[model samples]
Target: MTEDQSALKTLSEVVRDRRLQLGLSTRALAQRCIDPGTGKAIPRHYIQRLEDDLANLAPPRLPELSALAAGLELPLAVIQEAAGFQFHGVTTRHSESGRARMFVARFDELDPAEQDRVLAMLEAYTAVKPPKVD
Candidate 1:
């Protein structure tokens, strides 16, 4: 297991706090979000439910997750990480700190062709690893 890379918060708090930080009303947040997969605007009522009672709600699917990330103006990885830990009750070793971590977190945003190239690069690079410098 990896050390915590960020402070823990429930998905509700993550969304609510970020929304407030952006000075967005719940409706405004919802208005700004659309399911990336469907290209449909997310309902304001759904946003309200998420902020008000996320614990009782099923974890959002991938498209909604993308929408929330856009809405919150956070990387999709941050939202995914929070949701994964909070709802799935598990965390990932792949989730790391610093630039490398951010690279992996945003990796999913890449297209499949790009992902293949990245994976190839990762494998080639890691095949000749040097020790980290302090």
Candidate 2:
């Protein structure tokens, strides 16, 4: 399998395993993924297909992936990276207080495609902006 496919397979395994660990049915998971703004739940069949690796839905839009992460209660960054979002440089440093410092990018520093996906997710999460008070 190609590198991307291999990564996706790993992701599929993670999703299935985590779901089982949480004692959630496929339909339950889908229900958890309901978009607050849209009130749309990801279909149970799609989740099943994803877990079975019968679905080629990798590199999904960031909004969709974030919703999945919300339903799964997994780290968004972990899911995002597993979904093939390119990350920027990572660095670890030590401070005078003996604390470790880890640096990572949240959304910026990704490739254009990944950036667009993240932007879409942000938009979805903040569908209604607060009223401006000048």
Clashing pairs in 1: none
Please give the CA lDDT of all the candidate structures: 0.81, 0.64
- Best prediction by TM-score: 1
Please state every model's RMSD to the true fold in angstroms.
3.9, 12.5
lDDT of 1 at 79: 85
Instruction: Give the per-residue lDDT of model 1 (tens digit) for 5-115.
Output: 455665677899999999999889998887676787768888888778656788888888889988888888888878887788666455344777768876898999999
lDDT at position 36, candidate 2: 42
Q: Identify the runs in model 1 with alpha carbons over 4 angstroms from their true place.
A: 1-6, 92-97, 123-134
What is the Cα-based lDDT of residue 15 in candidate 1?
Answer: 91
What lDDT score goes with residue 38 in model 2? 54
Clash count, one per candidate: 0, 0
lDDT of 1 at 132: 86
On the 0 to 100 scale, the lDDT of residue 32 in model 1 is 85
Global Cα lDDT for candidate 1:
0.81
lDDT of model 2 at position 57: 59
